[model samples]
Target: MLDLNYILSSDYYKKELERIDRDNSVEQGLYFIIQSLLRSTIEEKYWVTDISTRSKKHIGFSKSVPDLTILEDGKTLFNPIAVAEIKYFPWSKKEYLTNNERQVKSYLKQVDKVIYTNGIEWIFLYGKGGSLERKESICLGNDRNTPESYYECINKKKLLSQIHWKNESDFKVSWDDLICKLGAFLK
Candidate 1:
């Protein structure tokens, strides 16, 4: 399980969010938080990285580049444990969901676990569940606001609050539970 307090209390987590707030294009800040979560939950060595830069062969299908690739300790490129697609909150709601969903479905064709997220909201996807499958395992922010409105309301406090928020669905998974699910995906 991930240590939420350890991540939330870290100066790095706080500072990175501030930096992300200033420059939406700098995705590396997310890596720090994700690495912290992985470090706490999994025992084996793993890498949270952008494999697009690795080599021509590693670039995803149709020249698409996923935002992050989680490689297990002994896993090869053919079998990454998980991959993610991230968008900045200010992007249009339709593009954020529609385009990203297309991209995530493409990813799911190869990788079993795919995480689609804006900085505030996370949606987990897995292939091969058929009609009964719930592509989104859990969401953290659980807000109904549109992407633009959500971005407009962002601040350090709001960001932290959203990160700590429970899932909106009947299941109501907490941050700790979400992290544990993520940990399971990586394992």
Candidate 2:
């Protein structure tokens, strides 16, 4: 579990978002956030980033680098617990969408939870009932009027716990809970 408050309230995250906006690249923004989450230490547990694996596709190739992969001992069976694909879109795009079911299933073949985001909207897909289920359209921010505004996935209770925006107050609550959940699943 990640400390939502710590991430949301951090000056580093804010400054990074501003930099991404100035560069007009939502992919960069998403990368920064994921890196921060991976760097975040919770109860002595730190997330590992970009744990690479060879895709089963036998193209006679060595290994390939995917965007991001997070591993934990719990529920991952010695594999990555989460894989994410981050995209970027301008404001002119009215709809943000993804094939979470397909994407998650493909990753789940090698990992657990699968998430896709385009800086504005995010879709999380995870295994349930022997199939993938989706939680969609989580809005990170409403400042879509600006072409350079930051958008992210709001912390949802199903994903973690109640998250306070832009405040350090109680960030540990969500982080602790998420670690526990991951531990239980791993066990």
Report residue 62 deviation for candidate 1 (angstroms).
4.0
Clashing pairs in 2: 74-186, 75-186
lDDT of each candidate versus the true structure: 0.56, 0.45
Q: By lDDT, who's the top model here?
A: 1
Candidate 1: how many backbone clashes?
0
Off by over 4 Å in 2: 1-11, 24-29, 41-43, 51-66, 73-78, 91-101, 119-122, 128-130, 142-187
Cα lDDT for residue 152, candidate 2: 38
* Highest TM-score against the true fold, candidate: 1
Residue-by-residue lDDT tens digits, candidate 1, 89-162: 44454566565565656676667777776545667777742111456645444333333454364532333322
The candidate 2 region of ten consecutive residues with least summed lDDT is 154-163
- TM-score attained by model 2: 0.51
C-alpha TM-scores of all predictions: 0.63, 0.51
